[model samples]
Target: MESIDRRLVHALQIDGRAPFAKIAGVLGISEHTAARRYQRLKERGIRVRGALNRFRLGHHAWTLRLRCTPDAGPALAQALARRDDTFWVHLMSGGTEISCLQQVKNPDELLLDRLPRRLVDVSAHNVLRGFASPGTWRGLACLEPDEVAALRPEFEPEPPTELTPLDEALLGTLEVDGRAGYADLAATTRTSESTARRRVEHLRRTGVLELRLDADPSRFGFATQARLWMRVEPRSLAAVGVTLATHSEVYFAAATTGPANLVASVTCRSGGDLYRYLTERIGSLDGVRETETAPVLRTLKRVALSEGEAFPCHA
Candidate 1:
């Protein structure tokens, strides 16, 4: 990708719904140029989708690691991807291990009474908290500080606002296309344009809706992507998670309950790059006692939701 494209992506990462004029001003391009570039990029696989803030809505998010039979992995992963609940699903360790992340209102649904009787084992980790996510990762941030500041959205801290059924219907459209026009959104929800616009703004200000840009790391020259499951000293887990999230290679990091307390998803340019990261970046961390690296062979789902998928701002 060119520097201008990276700048545009970075601006969107800061605020996905930023006006074309705002993006153009920051990138020193005309609004029409900015719009054209974005459309082209979208066609080339740069996607934006709206997601509900699960933690903010008092929902429990869990990451599951499944060790499956060699033949069952791909089909099982596809099945999981097609579901509205499972957002991130990856086939790792040469398609023998599956990593999935889903949000649930009741932790009991996943934690107990549900274990597929297949080959091997399964582990479920409840995300205690997230240090970094797609929205916060700045690894792709190429814009200058002032440029980023100019594009960042400003909103006061808001109390959690519950969503109505109509809001869920509206989000159904955004889950597929975050940049959908207000007219389209209103039509999908069968409401007036003014009502739809007002509701979306309210959701944004309240921290209920997050616009996530879905661009594969490989597109940006990071060919090697892996999940780092680190067993850290309990006392230093928080610090280690926070520090790892700041690294350029790490796109996702969180502290969770289970054997491996800290987990991160990292992308590097090559095998050599990954080795350097493990030996230099991760090795230097005093808290990370043992590290297990699971190379992500394929990602079947990411924030991908079908057009009719119902998010309801709950998960």
Candidate 2:
């Protein structure tokens, strides 16, 4: 991608709903150019979608890693990907391992018991807290601090409210397209345009939903992506997690349960860059005792709002 295109993507990452004129002004390009570039990128499957913030909704999140026989990995991963609760399904370290994120109100024993018999090992780390997520990562370092601040939305917290069936229906539409116009939202939810607008605003103010631009890192010159699992001293876990979260290379960082108490996803220009990060950055952290890195071979499914749909699972 051209430098301007990259900057445009960064702008969208900061605010997916940023006006074309605003993005053009930030990138020192004409509004026409910005609009055209965005159209091209969207044609390639780079898109922004509204997603639920599970934490804000009081739901528990988990990082699930499954090691399976080579032949069974893809099928198992796909099965998980098809479920509404699972997101970020990935094939890592070749095709024998699967990694995914899931959010739910409570543990589902029935879901766990349905795992494929061919699985060799399975680990589900409860994500106690997140220091960074797609919405928070500063991966595109092209913009100035002021430029970034200009694109950010003014946040005003709202009181928590139970999600009504109408709200869920509205969310389902937004999940597919965050930039959907008020008319579209109103039509989908079968309500007045003013009512739809007010409800969506309330959801955003309360932090129950977030809109994020999802794009492949490789498209922005980041060719290597890896997942880092680190065992940190319990006392220093918060410090280490916070530190990792501040790095531009770190996309997702969270404190999790199990032996590897913290897990982070990082993107870099190459293997050498990843090595430097692990050695110079993470290795120097005070509480990091051991680290294991897994290269993401391919992503079968990326982040999406839970559709809350049910599917048959292997028992």
Model 2: lowest-lDDT 10 consecutive positions: 306-315
Best by TM-score: 1
- Candidate 1 per-residue C-alpha lDDT over 24-117 given as tens digits, one digit per residue, 9 for 90 to 100: 9989999999999999899988877887665567777788899998888998888788876676788999989998787778877663345456
Clashing pairs in 2: none
User: Candidate 2, residues 1-315: lDDT per residue as tens digits?
Assistant: 788877887888888777788888878899999888888988987877887666566677888888899999888878887876787777888888888888878877325678989888988888877787766667776888998888777867797688988788888888888778888999988999998888888988877767777677787778999988999999999898888878999978888889999888899999999999999999899989999999998777665632211111111
The 0-to-1 C-alpha lDDT of every candidate, in the order given, reads 0.81, 0.80
TM-score of model 2 (CA atoms): 0.92
TM-score of each: 0.94, 0.92
What is the clash count for each candidate, in the order shown? Answer: 0, 0
lDDT of 2 at 28: 86
Candidate 1 weakest ten by summed lDDT: 306-315
How well does candidate 2 match the true structure, expressed as C-alpha RMSD? 4.8
Native-to-model Cα distance after best TM-score fit, residue 29 in candidate 2, in Å = 3.8
User: Where is model 2 more than 4 Å wrong at Cα?
Assistant: 305-315
